[model samples]
Target chain A: MSDILPPGSVIGILGGGQLGRMLSVAAARLGYLTHIYEPAANPPAGHVADRVTTASYEDADSLRAFAASVDVITYEFENVPTAALDLLEAAKPIRPNRRALAVSQDRIAEKDFLTGLGLTCAPYAAVSDMDSLQAAIAQVGTPAILKTTRLGYDGKGQARLRSADDAGAALADMNGAPAVLEGFISFTHEVSVIAARGLDGAVSCYDPGENVHKDGILHTTTLPANLSLAQRTDAVLLAARILNALDYVGVMGVELFVTPKGLIVNEIAPRVHNSGHWTQNGCAVDQFEQHIRAVAGWPLGDGSRHSDVVMENLIGDDILRVPQIATEKHAALHLYGKHEARPGRKMGHVNRVTPK
Target chain B: MSDILPPGSVIGILGGGQLGRMLSVAAARLGYLTHIYEPAANPPAGHVADRVTTASYEDADSLRAFAASVDVITYEFENVPTAALDLLEAAKPIRPNRRALAVSQDRIAEKDFLTGLGLTCAPYAAVSDMDSLQAAIAQVGTPAILKTTRLGYDGKGQARLRSADDAGAALADMNGAPAVLEGFISFTHEVSVIAARGLDGAVSCYDPGENVHKDGILHTTTLPANLSLAQRTDAVLLAARILNALDYVGVMGVELFVTPKGLIVNEIAPRVHNSGHWTQNGCAVDQFEQHIRAVAGWPLGDGSRHSDVVMENLIGDDILRVPQIATEKHAALHLYGKHEARPGRKMGHVNRVTPK
Candidate 1:
């Protein structure tokens, strides 16, 4: 455990996207200032953060300065450059450590780490080249997903194969990048558990939320996910086990596939996740603040939901519905402060409070 | 109603206090940028606002630049200089209007405005000098309060008169400033209705919260106030009437004295009030966000309370308990980011969720 941050301490966030923007807001509420470091100009988080350094990840000098200026450091995205982390970790403490990022950065490593902890993930094999890809496809069987081992998100950098005949096309889609052949897991639905581990190693997880996808992107997360009492206990326990394994301190989103036998791990986000946005309205302490508390060495807040919530992401043209959503009863709207609403860009989200 | 402020438009705020700090956070969530104009250096709102102009209100050049940069203007305090407002109103629209400020600025005007609207307020008489003070006190009777007409806040610039003999001492305490003598009202408890009036004239009011004061300062505000259904309706109706009478387009906190006969108006603040802080934990749309929505010309959101909350102000040494409060379940802490916590200064507040 590191020194507990007082109200005036600064929290440095690496990526200045919507997640960072929200984390900055949460930090400000807790009396901590956030300094944002991003490659892009006018990032959403920069609008709320106390300071911003607009420089590429390759810029070691700027990274050094950003790290020196902050008391504790955390990143919003998984794919942060290793060189930048080396600079940051030298001057400031980075919560969740670099190992979680290393595992989540690659599909093969994430699956290996989860399975190593006695957790069930989709059966997968490493794919190197065309020949190796073909061999891995044979072992993983048909109806598999060929995903780039690194830097892939929101269904990008991947291809789906329905049968053995489609292996060649899927292999070509990898573009010579290290890939993983994962056998598809037939499941009833997708649910996520947003779990937080404090500096003291105590863990707390919100109730799992069922998720729906549209065009391979998260569309909505409905709270009070359909789960038997046994499954709910299993979900929370596995999430805690993973955090303890990593010696992690921060909120991590664990996506799971509910199956007849048990729940299978999909992936984990090292920071606050989109699915957990419902906590902003449904719970006393939300995921953003939960992450801040964990990293700041403060005790984790109660991660209990008081009301049922349905959180819908506003992507691209979805922003046009702001006026209408403004009039909706019990609707809490949060925008990312992005100037241009590009297609597939997460503009904001609306959380609707439903009857418990 | 003026043209609606689009998501990216800038909202100018006059006073950069804690109220402005919360308002800036709410505006950012709604995708609007805020530019804070405050006389103080390094204000709490400036930490979150997109831009901050630190100059005295008398600085015409700075005020001009601030007005030019924002699309519309609003203020967090009622004591804004009339000359500064004259310059600002010429360039941009000020929601809640100058009339609201004028009415709330002077004790005599505030009382007269309420009485003219058929809203029952304690009887008050204007007093300019010693003769006028003696005459007004004779008419309003003993056990009255003598208050300065303007520039008074937080129980400052006022004296209580309990008897005819106490009139001379109370008048002397006024220091020859224009004053008003208000007759005392016997009430069981103090309750305030945090209400919002949108540009479309539609009004919404949150459930009244009972307030407790210590040393002439607000201590805590508990929701689900002890009031009958009829009293609750009357409170909301009277708040709406006051907003309509002022032609207001923003949030207003109306303090009421619940007496045997009816509710008597104590005062009204034409901005987010400290007593309404519980809404941050109890409602999806809080007073700060409600004021932002009303001033931005957006439709009003539901002001219904979801959880019963007790809001406690952390004044001065009260902030030392933050460490313990952080560990408490269902506690939402909002700090003003004041570097120094002097006695009587509000350092932060804690909103605790309690069973209804």
Candidate 2:
């Protein structure tokens, strides 16, 4: 019981977004019950989870109660409040650990960790005030982006500089938050490796998936990404290196920029990544199940895909195409139970499988 | 909204068993919520469903409340009480319709319906008293099965007769319940067709899966059953005929006995069957989703399989093998979340897929 959270054990999930919803369903498949904790009144995950605690992370009593009710805790989003984590951590185990969360919460720490592992990353510098902003621009050069180190997701809290002349305006977009200035580099495409590390120190990495973004949000991810064998191996190895360094115990999405020189570490998400959604149709054990298996102390599935798949996210009005997509052959539609189609909001996704 | 139950719609399931649990998960995938109604406390489906009403079916208030909360209603078990259905049906539409349920609820009605469709069935006669029981035995002969006409499942309420001398004992086993004597047919094998009919009157049928039984319970079902082209087509066409005749609007399991002359109709279930569980691994759209789609008035998926699969049920202690089965490649384990592994209880199932 101490090692494995057997079937019927309740798993507490910190966020109730699509990731949490998918994870809840995967846990249900393995005969585990899930309780979702989210501040939102009507979270998407609430529809599928066994229980949903609608309370803010700042509510100490609620956080403690949630932690007490479950065998272990895992999160969908990495920005869980430190005070809340402190209380919950004292009550129950939080998977992927605080170090992994801490490293990913801050862009500067993530970049430092990656570079420290001898991994390649874009030229970047930290920024606090106008003086540092100017210095960051001078050091990183033109065509850079200034992004807040925390609470940045799906292209929010980011401002891009076309050249040095735009540095002042881009810095203003930071709104006095701690920011990082990253110099842009020429790259062929972007790819991500969805990797996992188990309690037993076993690592399994899915094949690199080529990513396409629209309006700074992920648009699609296609499997069997165009990569030299060396680049593919480098992407997987670096992802493993990050997980190992953090002593991670769940699925992590490692984003990389494919440059002519080498693959550059762009960023990493401590939880299941949108880029790995294609695995739902391509592999026998999907990313969500893999995460649940790892956190539950079960044996890891060898990351082997049985089909070639192209996963396209249904952002906002893209859900309008579900009727037509549902009629298509080999298309598996996964909707997040989102009621409204707000622009840029992730509504759902479709994985189109091409049998090998 | 009149034609289709859109995402965010709540689907009401009548039984809180493993089938309802799976159906709830599938509905969640399509952005639908589910509420399960069952008499038992802490049902397996309650872990995954949006809500669970733990009240007896005879409670008209509970049935009405359950039906009123959801846009549409469906059932996982065929034996749902007619009185409870009457209350629910008055409040909401029940998919597969009352006709399908009525016909499948009683053996005599099911046999009559099948024979009415010009389908072949085992020779049988209904009996209610001692004189009638003797007459039935004389008509069907020995080496037959005398089963209760109503509420029989998994070999329960059944008594086998080895000779004419065994008729009185087999009749006594019925315990004054209405009975039917069916002459056993020498069949080479048994197969089942998982078929679906949409609201648009379109029909789709999955490939016939050969089944093997142990202790009168399903042990395994293998895909691509050894059926000639004509036999396969015949099996599917007959299933479609049954659905069309009933004006069914959901997935139906049609079990058939493959005899020397042709495929004989064994029985019909107006919901997802255990034999079709293989579709979870073999098809793009599984039987559960197909049922949900049909009940929700969505277009039916053309039943197509991408891989060969053998689905084996984990009865009782067979669940203990999960630790080892979890490590096997290409084997997908699905557990019911039931606490005790009682003998003959279906604990879970494993779908072993063979990719082409």
Candidate 3:
């Protein structure tokens, strides 16, 4: 067992987007100072963090000083450069570990790890070149998704293979980068369970949230997903299996395709998930605070939902509706403080609470 | 009546205590930037705010600069110097207004104002000097408390005159400062109502929280206080009446003594009260966020409680229980991140939720 850091200890966060911003806020609530190490200028997380180091991941001196200043380090995203982790891990412990990052950073490796645990996932094959793409298509078949193995999110670095004839086109989309071809899922709906694994190895999973995506961007997440009690229990157990398998030390978003046969794992995010944002207004212990508690080695809090909430993403022009949403009695507006509201950018979200 | 400031506008907070710190966090949630103007170095609020100006309130140049930088100003306390308000009000609007500060700054004026509004309070008389103190004591009778008219809080500047013989010594305890003698109220318990008003004259009030004080310092605030439906209705009405009377644009905490016959207004704080901290875990929109929304000219959110909560202050060494409390299910720790834990200092608080 490791010594739990009391108040006044600094937590180093590797990303400065909205997820990191919220994590810093949660850390501060628990009496911990946050040092945000983000390469981007004027990061949203820096607005609430105690200190912000503006330097690239390649800046070894800056990374070293940041690591030295903090008692523990955690990243808001899985794509943190391995080199930066190499520098920071030598100075301080990184929660969630590099093994989880390595598996998540590669599609083929992630599927292999999941299958090794006897978990069900979509059919996928490694596509290294045109020949591999053709071979993988012959196995996984058409109506699949071709995606880069690393550094892709929000539907980026991906192409859809509608038919066998589109194989060459999909290969062209990869541009020689290592890619993944996943067979299309005939899921009734998509759901995600946000699970946290404590340093003590205790796992807690929040109720799954049913998600709706528009143009591959999350549109809304409705709580109490239309699933039977048995499905809910199965989803949670599968999520815990993933967390335990990874030896995860923080919150993980496990996206699943709910089908007639059972639940099929879609993808996993090593940080707070956008689909779980409804917990901010629906549960007493939110995902952000849960993540902070897990990273800080504190006990996992109650993740039970107190209120039914429907969360809607405020993307680009959706912000214009804030004037109306702000007046809605049960709607809690959560803005990210982002200056520009460009299309597809997650400016903020509003959680509308409904009485149970 | 006025335009609500957009999200990115800066909010200037006047105090640097835990209240300000929580306020800054709340402002950030609403997508507003906070700039803390505190006289003390490394103020708790500064750790979360986007900017901090550490200069004495008496410093005219710093005060001017702080006011100019923010779109609107609101304070975390009622005792701001009149001269400072005079300078800041010329640059930007200070919420809760000067009338609130003037009335709350002087105990005599506060009592007069409350009585003028036909509110019932304990028998009291102002003591300008020793002769007046003697006369006030004779009128208010024995077992009365003598408190300084200005700069008194948390049982700090008050002395209990238990008997007639203790009058001279109690008067001497005032140290020649103006004071008030009040006949102690015989009440079953103390409850406080946190109410807010908006720019368009809208009002919202949270349920009353019953408070217990130890050594005149707040010990705990238990929600769903033992009160008849009529008493609850009266509490909300009285609180709304006070807000409407002041044309208040922020949250106010109204403390009342529950007597056998009816409720008697004890005193009021022009800002968020310690008694209302339970809202952090009990309600969807907490007192801090309510204050921010009102000051920002945004529409008020629902202030209804979602769960029963008991909030206990982590004063001084009480923080030592944080490790144990962190493991307690449904207990949410909210620490101020103060560097030192001095005696009687409010280091943080724990909001224990009762799953009703």
Candidates' chain B TM-scores in the order shown: 0.98, 0.99, 0.98
Off by over 4 Å in 1: none
CA deviation > 4 Å runs, candidate 2? none
| TM-score for candidate 2 | 0.99
lDDT of 3 by residue, B1-356 (tens): 24789879999999989999999989998999999999889898988999999999899999999998999999999888989999999999999888888888899888898888888889899987778878887898879999999999999889898887887888888898999999987999999999999887899999999999997899999988989999999998988888888888999999999999899999989998899999887777899999999999988887888888999999999988888887787787899999898999999999888754
Instruction: Say which prediction, candidate 1 or candidate 3, comes out ahead on DockQ.
Output: 3
- A45-93 per-residue lDDT for model 2 (tens digits): 9988999999998999999899989999999999998999899999999
I-RMSD for candidate 3: 1.7
Question: Per-residue lDDT for B1-356 in model 1, tens only?
Answer: 23568778999999998999999999999999999999999888987888899999999999999999999999999899999999999999998899999999988889888989999998889988878878988889878999999998888999998887887788888898999998987899999999999998999999999999988899999998999999999999999999998889999999999999999999999998999999998988999899999999998887789889999999999888888898898898888888888989999999998545
Per-residue lDDT of model 2, residues B1-356, tens digit only? 24888788999998999999999989999989999999999999988898999999889888888988999999999889989888888889999899999999999989988998899999999989878878888898878899999999999999998987887888899999998999999899999999999998889999999999999999999988989999999999999999999899999999999988999999999999999999998888899999999999888864698888999999999988988888889988898999999999999999888786
Per-residue CA lDDT of model 3 for A66-101, tens digit only, reads 999999999998998889999899999999889989
Clashing pairs in 1: none
Of the candidates numbered 2 and 3, which has the greater lDDT value?
A: 2
